[model samples]
Target: MADNAPAPPPLYDNTPTISEKEDPSALPPELAGPCSDQAQVTEEEGVASDIADKEELPLPPDPVETVTVTVMESQLLQKELPAQENPVAVEAEEPKLGEETELKQKQKLGQALQSLKEESNNVSDLTESDQKALLELKQLIEEALNEFSFSSPPEKEKNLAGTLAVEVSIWGIPLLKDDRSDVILLKFLRARDFKVKDAFTMFKNTSHWRKSFGIDLLIDEDLGDDLEKVVFMHEHDKEGHPVCYNVYGEFQNKELYEKTFGDDEKRAKFLRWRVQFLEKSIRKLDFSPGGVNTIFQVSDLKNSPGLGKHELRQATKQSLQVLQDNYPEFVAKQVFINVPWWYLAFYSVISPFLTQRTRSKFVFASPARSAETLFKYIPPERVPVQYGGLSVDPCDCNPEFTISDPATDMTIKPGTKQIVEIIIYEKCIIVWELRVVGWEVTCGAEFVPSTEGGYTVIINKAKKMTPADEPVVHGSFAVSELGKLLLTVDNPTLKKKKLLYRFKVKPLGD
Candidate 1:
C-alpha cells in the first residue's frame, strides 16, 4: 500500500511538527552565558557576587568604625557671644600729654593701669579666640614701637616745607600742617591756645606778626545778670583816616577790601599788598539794632531763614528818612519819597510818566519864604492901565511920588497886561514919608481917572532890596470905570518903587 505512504512519514502528521526545547543547564556553559568568559569576567559581575555573599553573611554584633564624635570645648562657637567692650575704659587707659609734671604723669599712669586692669576684668567674658587675636594685635603694636622709638626726633621736620601753620582750631578741629603760608594761619584764632598773653609774646618776638594786621580782642564786662563781650579791631593809618573795622565773624582777606577803597588802577596793587601784609582771624561779633545801617558788605550773611530781611528793611527805612531830611530841595524833588528806599531808587528813573506828572505843577511850594511870597502879588486885577504914547514916568513926579533914580525901565505892549516878575539885585534906601502920594479924586469918587489918560499917580515904593531881604511889594491897580479906590502901603517908599515885584492883571483862575 505504497508502504502505507511510508506511514505518512510514520504518522508524521502532515500537520506542523513540535521541536524539542533544550534546557539551559543542559547547554554548554559558554553558550548559555551572555557571551562572557570566566577568565575575562567583568568587575560588575564580581561586585554582584560579592553583594550576594554579603547578603548571605550575618552582620557582626557591632560595626568596626562605630566612633562617637564629641565636640571639644572651644571659646568660640558658644551660644552667647562675649560681651563687647565699653569705650569709656579706653579713654581712661591712655594718659593725655598736656600741661602737667612728672608726678602728675605718674599719677595719670597709675590711673591708666588701674583702668586697664578694670577693662581686663571684662576680658574673662570674651571668647578665647577674640582674646587671642587682641593679644596678637597688642604684641604686634609693641614690636612696632620697639622697632621705631618716639625718643628719636628728626633734626629737620618731614613734610613741613609746604605744611599749613595754624595757631588755633579750624571749624572746632585742630589745624594740621605747619607751613607759614597756610591759609589756616590767617583764619580765626581760638582763645584756648592763642590767649592775649600768648599774643603779646608772639607780637614781641615775631617780626612777621606786625601792625599790618589789626588786633581783635574781647573785653569781659560784667553787666547786670549777664556778661557782655565787646569786639573791635583798629586799623592804624598814617596818611588816611584811621578806621576801626568790625570783627564779627571770620577775618576776610583784604582782597575784598580793595573793592571799598582806591580807584581801579590802584586797587589791584593795594589789595595785593593788603593780602600780604594784613593778617586776621575769625572773630565773634556783638551788635545792636541801630548798627544795621553800618553793614557795608554782606556776602557771608546766611540765606537760610533770611534773618537779614528784617534788619535790611529797618535799615532801608532809616536811610531813606535821613536822605529825605538832609537832601537839597532840588535833589529831594528828584528822588521819590517811597516806603522802601531800594524800590524808590529802582523805580525813580524807570517810571517816566510818574516823573512827568510830579514835575508838571508849577505851583509847587518853594522851600524858601521869599520865593513863596512872590507868587501871591502876581495875581490878576493888579495890572496897570496905560494909554498909547503915554510917557507918564513915576520918576518924573518927584515931589509927590519921588521915583527911584536909576529907575527900572518897564516895557508894556498895547492892550496887553502881562505880569512882570523882577528879582532884587541890589540894596537901595528910599525915604518913605516924604516920597509917597495918592491919585486925584473928582466928584466924590464917581469921576475918577479914566483909562484913556486922566491921572498918572504913584504911591510908596523902593528901588532895590538887600541880599538877605525879599519884599514883594509892587504892583499897579487899574479902574475899568472912572472911579477912585483907596490905596494903602505900610512902607510908602515900598509902594512907590519896590525893588522886586511881579504884576499880573488877567482874569482869575487863568
Candidate 2:
C-alpha cells in the first residue's frame, strides 16, 4: 500500500490566497481537471464548497498499494420480509377453533358475498327503486299467504272442482196439436228453440198455419200471432191413439150450433165455450160428441149454413121430442142424452133432475111411413118447458090425403087433388096393381098419365080377359121414358073400382 497521502483544506480569509481561491484548480493540473467545471464558484458560496469537497478525492486510483480481492455477499434475506410464505400455510397452520370458526365464517362470508353479487347481477337490469319495490311486494305477498280470508273457498272437492251453480225456469208445460200435420208442427217447435232459427222457421212455416179459418183451422198471413194463441184440437189421444170419427163439415159451421141447441139454456153454455175459445161468436164451429142422442141429431143433416132462428128452434124441439119418446124414464131421470155436439161446459153444472118444473123429458118417435103414420109419430113431448112440433112440409102444417070410391071404381088423390108427375130420366120397368075384392082386372081400363108433376088416369075403354091380373100378380104397365107414358081411364059403366093400389118401381142410372 502507498502511504503518501496528504490533503489540505481550502483557505479563504481576507483577500484569500490565490492558491486558496483557486481551490484545487490552482494546485495541480491533474486536480484542476476535476475542479474546472466549477470555475465560477465564489469562495463563500456553499455551492462552490460542495464542488471543492467532491474534488478532494485522488484523481487516479492507487494500483500497487491496493490488493484486488473480489467478494460476493449474499444474505439469505432471513430478514423475514413478512414471510412470502402465505400466512395461511405457515406452521402447518394448525387451525385454532376460533381460527377455524373464523375461517368458516370467512368462507361463509365469501359465499354470502358471492351470492349477494349474483343476486345483484340478476337485479342489475332493474332500476334501484324498482328493485326495492319488487322486494317489498314479494314480502307483502308472503304476508298475505299467512292471513285470514274474508271469503275463502274450501279445499277443492275431488271430481267437482269447477261447477258450482245452476239456474232453473219454465220446466213443465203441455203442448197439444192435431194429427193431420203434427210432424211439421213438431219440427217447427224444435226449430223455435233458438231465436235466430225460430224466426226463420216461422217465416217458412206460415203456410201451414194459414189454412186455419176460425175454429176449422188456425193461421194468419202475418207473423204477429203467438204460437200458443193458435188453437189446435188434438185429433189423437195422449198415447197417440187416433180418434176415429167423421168431423163433418156441418159440425164446423156455426149454423149447426144454432140448429142443434136452439135457444135453450144448454145452448147458452155451449156458446160460452165457443166464445172462450176465440172470444167471438163461432165464425166456424168445431165439435166433439158426448152421447148417442147428440149423434142422432147431427148424423142425418147436411153441413150447409143459414139455418134461421125459427128453423133451428123447430129442429131442436123435434130432436128432443124424438129422444124423449124413445126413453121416457131416461128423460124423467135426466139421464144424459147423446147430442150431435160434445158435452157443453154447463152440463157439468145443471145435471140430474132439478124439480118437476125444470126437469126435462125427451122422446124418440119412429120415422113416419105414411101420412097417417106421420100424424101419429109427430107430437110435442108429454111434459115440456116449451111446446112445439115438427112437420115435414114446405108449409107449417102437415099434408093430408083421401081415397074416394063410387060404385065399382075407386079414385085416390092427395088432399089438394094436385096432379103429380115424375119424368123418367132413364128406361125402367113399372107395374101398378089394383086389388079390388082381392082381384086385379086385365085390360079393364084405359089410363092417362099427367104431364105436370103426377100421373092423371082417365078410365075410358073396358075389356074382359080370361085370366085377370091377379094372385101374386098385377096389371104391369112398363113405361120407357125420355119418351112418355100416357094413360086415360074413364069408368063409363059407372062401376066403382074399390082399389087398393100398391106400386113398386126401380130407376136405373149409370
Candidate 3:
C-alpha cells in the first residue's frame, strides 16, 4: 500500500501540563524561572542587576535632595510588554563615563536603555540553542505564512509560497519586519523552552486564535463600563514594568455578579471584556527587545465568591484557557493578595493549565501580609491609595501631591512607637500625607525647634486610630521659623503596621 504520510505537525504543545496531582511544593518559590531564560524575566534578579549596576554608576549627586532607591529581592521580576505598533530594539548611543557629569542623572535613564540593549532583542540574551531554535521558528513561520495567510484582520484566503509575507503581523508588528519580530518570536520560543516545533505550533495557533476570536474587532468594542473598577492598569512596578490589578471583590456585589455571570451570554461578554482589556493593555507595552514586555499581575481575592459560585469558577477556567493559549509569556508575576483559604482550591483548578515556569512567578499572601507583600515588589508611593499607598487617583481632589511624589514606607512593631522627623532649616510651608495600613494604632505630630526658645507645636493630637478611621492623614503647616516636624505612630495591638508618608516643603514667597 503506500508509505504513511509523515506525521502531521502537532497543533498545540502535547507536553503534559503541571497537575495538582503532581508535587505542589516544588512550585511558587516566589519565582525560580523568570530570569532563567531571555524570553522573560527582567523584573527580578536579572532586572535587579540592571538596577544594581545603576546604583553603582558614579553620578553627580542631586542638589535639591538625594533620591532614595529601594531594591527588593534579587529574584526575577516581571511585567508583560505590550505589543506596540512600531516598537523596535533601539541601538541608542551609550553615554560616556563622567560625560555630562552634571546631567548624570539623565544618564541613569540612558544606562537603563543601554542595559536593555545588552539584555534583550540582541544575541546576548540567547544561547546557541536559543539562536538555533529562533532560526528554525522564523523559517517555519515564513513557510506557514506563505502557506497559510495570517494577518491582523481582513483575512486573505490565498496561501502562496512565492515569498515570505510581510503582511502577516501580530500585535501590529510584521512577522519579518525587524528585530521586534524576533522579540515577539522569542516569547513563544521561551514559553516552550526553545522547542522549535512547539514554538512554531504556538505561533501558528496564536495567529489563528486571534483571527477566530476577532480580537482586532473586539478591541474596539464597547462592552460596558460596569467592570471598570473590577480590573485596571495602574502605575509601574519597582522594575518599571506596568502593573495590572484585578479586584475580584468588586464582583461580590450581587447585581454585578449576576450581570457578569448570570448566564452563558453574560459570561461570554465578561470574557470578551477581559480579553479586550488585556489586548488594550498589551498595546501599551513596548515590545522592543530590551523593553519591559511582560506585565505584573496582582489579583485581589478579598471577598471573592467562594467555590459554591459555579459561574465564577467556570468563567475563571475559560479565561485561564484563553490566556494560557494566546497570551503565552505575557505575565511577569502572578500575585494573589488577600488570598482566602479556598485559594488552594482555586490554584488547583488552574494549576493543570500552567507551565512550571509560569507557576514559579506566583506569589501568595494572606490578608495581613497582602499590603506588605505588595510593598516588596511595588513601592508604597506607586501603589494605589485604597491599597495603602500615597498615590491618589487623578479624579480625587489631592491638589498638593500627585503620584509622582516619592513616599517613604516603614513598619512599626507592636507595642512600640516610631517617630518620623523632618527637619526644616528654612522658612517654608510644609504639606504632608501619611497613612498606616490597618490603623489599629495612635498617631500624632509635633514640631520641635532648633532653638530652645522655639515653642513646640502639636499639629495633630495623639489619637487612637482604628481600622474604622479614614486610611490617610493629610496635614499642612505654615512654618515661619526653623524647626523639625515629628510625626509619631504608636502601635498597641500585637500586629505590626505599615507606615507611609510623603511631604513637600514650599519655600516662602513662592
CA lDDT of each prediction against the hidden true structure: 0.21, 0.23, 0.62
By lDDT: ranked, best first = 3, 2, 1
Model 2 residue runs over 4 Å out of place are 1-415, 431-476, 480-504, 507-510
| Model 3 CA deviation exceeding 4 Å by range | 1-121, 151-166, 341-356
- Reference-based lDDT, residue 53, model 3: 18
Candidate 2 or 1, higher TM-score: 2
TM values, all candidates: 0.14, 0.16, 0.74
lDDT score, candidate 1: 0.21
Cα lDDT tens digits, model 2, 140-237, are: 32332233111123522223544222211000111111221222222223223323334233523332222221222222222221211112222221
In terms of lDDT, the best-performing candidate is 3
**Which lDDT value does model 3 have at 139?**
89
Clashes of each: 18, 44, 14
